[model samples]
Target: MNKNIITLEYRISKLLRYGVMLAGALMFVGWMSMLDFTQNPLLAFHDYREVTFVHSIGYAWRDKVWGLLTAYAGLILLISLPLSRVLMTAILFWRQKERLLSGIAFFVFAALIISFSLGIEL
Candidate 1:
């Protein structure tokens, strides 16, 4: 492998690791908050699943549901990590003059975006 590719791989590895750690930390804080809020060691599925993303964010800010907000933020971060990797792959392939690989990477990225958008309801 090229030195540049090796370096890019290292950077991508770090990005994934740090992203997961940050998300895990946020989730841990959210879990602890939930425990406090509910005064129970175990949580029910309905506790966190009752609101949509927009509503959870609003509740997090306006209704002081910090746990829900933090948890959702963590989930969003987790979901975006793979997308970020795809984006980085495309950029690196372009920089290395690998046109075909770059094009494929871009195609995959576009497909992911389209699928995600399609999954959302109006």
Candidate 2:
């Protein structure tokens, strides 16, 4: 019975981890689409300029798209972050066999929770 409980918890934790990663990916993609990185660095800018072929393409789409990408990106990140933590906690509870993974997941989830809660966007 005790083993079964642990297994159940472990499975929940795994699901949570997967959820957080998915949320993070979605948020990252959304957050990235917001900026005209071709023109300005929203986050980091040094004397060095950041340029990408992708930004060039995005530039063309920018006027036509009418900020849809930025809107969607913001929405997804805002929604996914909290959801990610919930999922992470669930996964942590579910995965017991893999101690290393569980530990890593816990730390990652914890950090994500703190960072996201603080609204520290990359």
- Pick by lDDT: which candidate is best? 1
TM-score of each model, paired residue for residue: 0.82, 0.36
Measured with C-alpha atoms, the lDDT of residue 16 in candidate 2 is 61
TM-score of 2: 0.36
Model 1 CA deviation exceeding 4 Å by range: 37-50
Please provide, for model 1 over 35-111, each residue's C-alpha lDDT reduced to its tens digit, 9 standing for 90 to 100. 75544565465476655656657767998888877887898898899999999999998998999999999999999
Question: How many steric clashes between backbone atoms does each model show?
Answer: 0, 20
Task: Write one digit per residue (lDDT tens) for candidate 2, span 1-122.
Answer: 47777776587677666756766666566556655757755444446655453574476476665344544454565566555655555565555465667667777777766876677333
Q: What is the lDDT of residue 29 in candidate 2?
A: 66
Off by over 4 Å in 2: 43-122
